[model samples]
Target: MINFINKFKGKSSMILRKSKPYRYLICILVFMTTYALLAMGLLPEKYSLEVAQVSPATIYAPRTVVDPYLTKLAEDEAVAAVPEVYNLEASITVAALSGLNQTYASLEEAAIEEDPQEQELLLQAIKENLSEEIEISHVRKFINLTSEQREYIYTNTYEILERNLSQGIKIESIDRAKNQVINELTLLTTDRDIRDLLIDINVPLVRANLLYSAEATERDRRQALNEVTEVKILKDTKIIDQGEVVTELHIRQLEALGLQETSSQDFGYYLGLALLIGIVFIIIGVYLNIYNQSILVDSHKLLLLGIIFCLTLLLSKAFSYFSAYLIPITLAPLLITILFDRNIALLLTIPLAIFSGIIVGNEFTYIILALTSGTVAVFSVRKVNQRSDLTRAGVIIAAANGLTLIALSLLTGSFQGATDFIKNISLDIIMGMVAALLSSILTIGILPFLESAFGVTTSIRLLELANPNNGALKRLLIETPGTYHHSIIVGNLAEAAAEEVGADPILARVGAYYHDIGKVSEPYYFIENQLGNENIHDSMKPLESSKIITNHAKEGVSIASKFGLPPVIIDLIQQHHGTTKIAYFYHKAKEQGEGEINESDFRYPGPKPQTKEAAIIMLADSVEAAVRSLKQPTKDKINDIISTIIEDKIQDGQLDQCDLTLADIKKIKEKFAKVLLGIFHQRIQYPQK
Candidate 1:
């Protein structure tokens, strides 16, 4: 088994390097496509029905929406609960007081008449002008009293009317208010006639003082209506049972959601959904631009991301057609974590979860399931070693999904009877486990295709390539033992240096193991694989010798590619020697040739090391070869050779294209010296027994 040593250092193939505008355009297209899919998927299936029509199928509310008709009913009930409001008419009281004062003046004037007959006639006329409650006898007796007494009666009556009438009195309370006025007048005087006259006068004035105020009444009703909450039709709630007669209420409910045949689509609903989806896309784009600019600028990665998103969405929606719990929500995170880093995978899981939840009829249950399952899958595959590790991750995801379902069931109280509860719980656990397992299975199955399509070297691929039993490594061991031994030592040295500099140690180590794989093709032609005291170069021309040595880098790339090694490993094999010249052959040619010898002919064809790991392998390979050629490589000699080899590469401009800093190169030198000291350390000779 291969030892998996480091975090993944896969490089996605750059299909196209996009300019700024094209990058933005690609993002916009992805966002628009995703939004369009979500919008179309979320729309509920419409039904054609009328009042009294039998429903063909049982319909559940696609999304949680406010039932406009039901909400109006609730508002109406709330308004009914509020009492009617009325206002007191101050003008009525004023009119009553003025009428009383005029009547008192008329009675006083009639009392001033000389003839008793004339005064009686005047009292009769005054009686006719009074309210029906006031009899002619009561008026005549009131005129018989002295003017002072009449004025006193007037003053007490005026006070009684003013006080009682000012307070609001609806039509229902008018009788009680009149009785209150009668009691007050009865308490005013001992004389029956005077009491009778005051009772009749003030009681009549106490007409209904309260008036119905439409504005005030309507204001109170509307306030009560405002306080009533909207009656929402929750998601998954059954709108109509199969074969049940459709009522006006059902029709209205369907109309509110635009599910009715005759109902027009609500543009506001689509607009709002579009805006929300657009915002999420903008946030993700901003995050990528700020943090993952490499992916942002590369159209291939962007296209890959878009394809993954669409595939996950398509599957989620398709699976949701059966049961929401069966949707493989973890697929996105698993694929993303393999293709990219975990941070991006983790961040993007949120939107995928939410969108899947929406696709499955807007259930929060699926949303929670997706989020938890995806998160667990990401953490589980953080350091996968082989393909089987993905299956193990599947089991881990399954366990997490099962536990999450149980917790959700407990929170939602979805279980019913004891028997039903156990059955439902078991089904939930099984479905969640299946979905999670499906995510892993799909990830494992799709990874190879994505790897090939995108030219990405994932951690799983690296671990497989690193195995000693692999075909390429095995061929090197069997055919070119010396080269294989040299490769192993170079691997150890490069791995240590890569670790010290925070480069990908696994990439460097594995690359070193296969750097000289081309030697297997013509094993004895190279010095490492030649027999003792046998040199093929002894008989060969210097120019031909230089060609063989330099051609190995190219040959190694072809071999690695033929073995299906990742492009990263192929690059390492090709760039390990860079363009450094075969100094011995080049100098020999200079000495032997009668004409000028070109330096370019002696150098290896190379694009140079483009990454930190490739650079470390290049340096380690040179250091190992030079140190091995020395006789009695003491610690001082090894250290000097390591420094000289690295310094020569630097001076030759071989390290200029890579991103290694001076400090990093210093650390690499120290690390190489320390590791080489151990490899070439002096050994004590055991005495022969």
Candidate 2:
């Protein structure tokens, strides 16, 4: 069981370490967690409810907020207030007039005809057309009427019907039009049959003419509702009273306030959050690929960067739970600046600030604050010479945070009066300062662990290693004191050159200090550690002496790794000599007329300087040794020797693998001359003291 568990653990570790997908999964998981947390209180909730439920308690706006629920409700109310629409048809009046005129013509034709039965039949047909219940006796009296009586009834009935039904007729008001027509016809004639004919024919025919338009009514209501804008509930506004019955409005308010816990309609909200997270990650990925591809491809760098970003975000989010001002926005940027370069730190800071602004709910203000503080943090320790520089950077960042808070306070009108301004601003200032100071303190505390765990070589770590008490350097000093002294001068020259070329001088100095640790293994075998006239190499063969010399680069790397030094320093130890041949021993072997010696055996095993620091150290090692060989060296001799060594290295392709350019080499040469001139400056022969 124990073996099985160990095997399973080993397999899991291998899968996690070797698979890009697993690392990506971890990265996306962290991103999604942050996105979910940010979206929790920021979006509105969807509630499951109906009308008239008892509200559990009073609710107020948690922050400055927009109530989309209230907005929709206002739109609905506006729609309800709109009056119903109807359609008027003028054809109804025209049809009624035509029917009355036809009746009158039938009555006139019946009065002139000798056939009274036909006339009565026509008038009866007209009466039936008006209404099936019209009396037959009334039809007979209408047929017997004179033309004048018929014309009067026709004109009067047609006129009344036109006046009433032509413009519009509501379905509910149909009877009023019928009544008006009846009253108008009654006054027009005293004859009972004439009155009955007009009333019976026209009154029944006076039906509701206007059509109810449901589609048109809805359209009009919608148009009116559209005029109303969305309603927003302000921060701290009271939404309900305790024990108040929950109306639909109350439910809407609760949803708008994001207080309803169970919302089924949050897919869009979560999707938007996902999109935001994806965009931020893509931007960070593209930038790293373009400017720092090594970090993007290497799992250690990628995971370490993600860890720092997430830690900073989580801490900021935690602080925001208490107050947004307590967000230590500078921490990630400062930490990156110390561990990595300022460019990577600066590049990542922008996205960090954007995420902070989104998380805190006031993007403009929070963005400004984060950017100002993060930028200060970047510049503060960009080229940290010692640990104290980190402290100084923290103070500067804190001061910048205070100033930014002051500006924001004044701009936002966050004060009722001068005293209020002072009190509030002071509190905010303290929060900002404490956040920056805490970030600085935390960064310093965690920096060593990060450097060790990630295999990163920061200047602070280099400085720590450069201390005299370091085990390897101490061993070199005690076992090979001459080599240690030689290393110190080489370090000084390399540091000056690195500084002139805008490279890391601290890295150069630290690398130079430990570059000769291999000499400690066999101290007396090398010239620098020899004390008496007899040299150990004089008794040895050229091949043996050359082998000892060649083996030191490999031995130095071994010693550096044993000391737990960074890979960068080990790289310096391994590559400082590059593949340069030990010329004296090689020539001596050739002059001895030994069978053709293989050139490869005399050369140092090397991956020639892989960085500017290592390359600079390589040059310094050779220049310091070459200058030391000159008896009573003058300033001119030191200058010429330094220039020749640099040129020779360039021609030998020693700097080809590193990033050093022609311009950087020129600056390095000038810096060497300046430093070497000081070391070999002409002394004045003053009067004997």
Candidate 3:
């Protein structure tokens, strides 16, 4: 029963390891738990109110007036009548004055001439010249006079003229004074017209004042117009009597009518909203995992990176509560890139952005901010190599964030408020910079665990390992100096060849440095590690010698695993030897008539080179070793050796498994020939002894 239980547990573990659904469930659980805790109060419930006001439409009208041409004709006619009215008054005055003058003149003529008939006629004309009675109705309105007023003016005018005559004025003086007399008569008669004119002028002035007051009152009333409506509710309440003051309870009851109670369902709705947001974030995380190639290495690395990314998101939220200036959420992707690969960093950036949004409360502003920062972080540090590189990248991220914030502020017209604008802008820069720094810090902290568990050899780690003083490399140098020197040359050759074919030159170089590391186990058995000593292989049988040499490939893989080399480098170490036979030992055995010898025993273990770098390293290794065996090296000999090695590998089907095509092989052969020629170029012949 115990064994069965153990088997069941193993199967479950295997299933869990292979199951995508299980991982997805774990991711969802993590997201939900984090959202529930970190975003509890982060999300704010949004409420909207729409308001509209009712207003009266205004209308405008123009005042009407009589036709201009008709009014002009009426004014002209009235002006023409004024002259006639004045002429009539003048004619009457002239006639009355002429008669008075004639009476006086005739009396003087009768005393002087002794002509009785002339004298009598003159006297009769004077006596008969009575003042003509004029009809005044046509000029009455203009003159503003009543009939009694006109008569009184006429009497005064006559008396003034009689007074002038009584003062003994001469007849010539009377004729010249006729105009003065007429003017006096006209003034007396028109006094009532002037008084009535004053009344007419005063009436319009009074009416104008009243109209102005009415217009002003109408303007004020229009300004004061307002719509007021009252709503009443049915309720039972105590009321005060009409003569008594209202009690506080009455006022409280009125106030209670204005209060509203919110429904409990609102909170439930908000909770569901939060859940939906959390689910969206989880879905984003899963999609990012599937499609993002950078982070999609083996399952182990993905898991480690996912955990770190999620943790960073949660920690950023927790720290944000204390102060929003703490750990930047975008640093998660940057950190992944720093410790792992850029592809992974870019892939994880999406989920990390989603997590950042959730932590900051799922607002559109926060989501956009997080996404912008994360994208900037990933792009800015794509080529980061050192700790200080992250600092530079951090500054870049800060600048990008600042620019984005300033642009947004400008677009939203919120830049007028200096304090809030500067504060928000500063926060964006600080968060971006802090994210970069924190990413570097967290990357350094988590790198060892990830490297150990996933066997990732970052460039920084490789540089550290390349130092001659490193324990493993130093041991190889001191104990097997010849092998060490050979490995360095092979590394140089492999790096050049790998670069020519557009393969990973760093991996090729590093693999070359460690490719023959197992030769250190039996240092003297290999030719390069034998120093000046005798050949160990000469004393051993062909098959035994072949076995010893073939064993190094297996031993190198074991050592690589023990030392935690990545699977890619380990594959290179193993497949660098491929299934090629140990030709020297195997051919010697054939010539010696060795019967029934297993060919497989003489070959390196089976998996051929699967990548260009591994295949290049294998070819470089063979060409370098074969060129060293030539007695007198020449360009022709070096070229022949390189071509033979390539052709032999091709004919033996060792290159079949690798992706190198016939065209690629030809290119590789040319590159090898050129490099070999340069290495074996002729030097100046020394002077003979």
Point to the candidate with the largest lDDT. Answer: 1
lDDT at residue 4 of model 2 (Cα atoms): 80
The local distance difference test score of model 3 is 0.62
Q: How well does candidate 3 score on lDDT at residue 337?
A: 70
Model 1 TM-score? 0.77
- Model 1 per-residue lDDT at 678: 89
By TM-score, is 1 or 3 better?
Answer: 1
Candidate 3 to truth, TM: 0.61
* Model 2, TM vs. native: 0.75
* Candidate 3 local lDDT, 1-689, one digit each (tens): 97588579657765665667766666666566655555565423322211121112211111121223343444555444432111112333455456544533443444344465765564445334322222222222422344455445435644766544334333334444544444544554345543333222221111101012345454444443322112223332222233334334333322333211222434554576567656766565576567664433334545666577667766766776754434566667666776665666665566566656555544345555566777777777776545566677767766666676677667777656888778656776566556556655666666666676556666656666667887667777988898788878778888887777777777788888888877877788988877666898888899999988999888877776566567677788899989998988988888888787778888999589989988988998898889877888898888888888888988888888878877777777887777777777778999999
Q: How many residue pairs clash in each candidate?
A: 0, 0, 6
Model 1: clashing residue pairs?
none
The collision pairs in model 2 are none
Cα lDDT tens digits for candidate 2, 497-554:
9988878889899899999999988898888888988988778789999999989889
TM-score of each: 0.77, 0.75, 0.61
TM-score-based ranking: 1, 2, 3
lDDT of 1 by residue, 55-145 (tens): 9999888777899899989988898898877888888888888887887788888978889888888888887876676678777777788
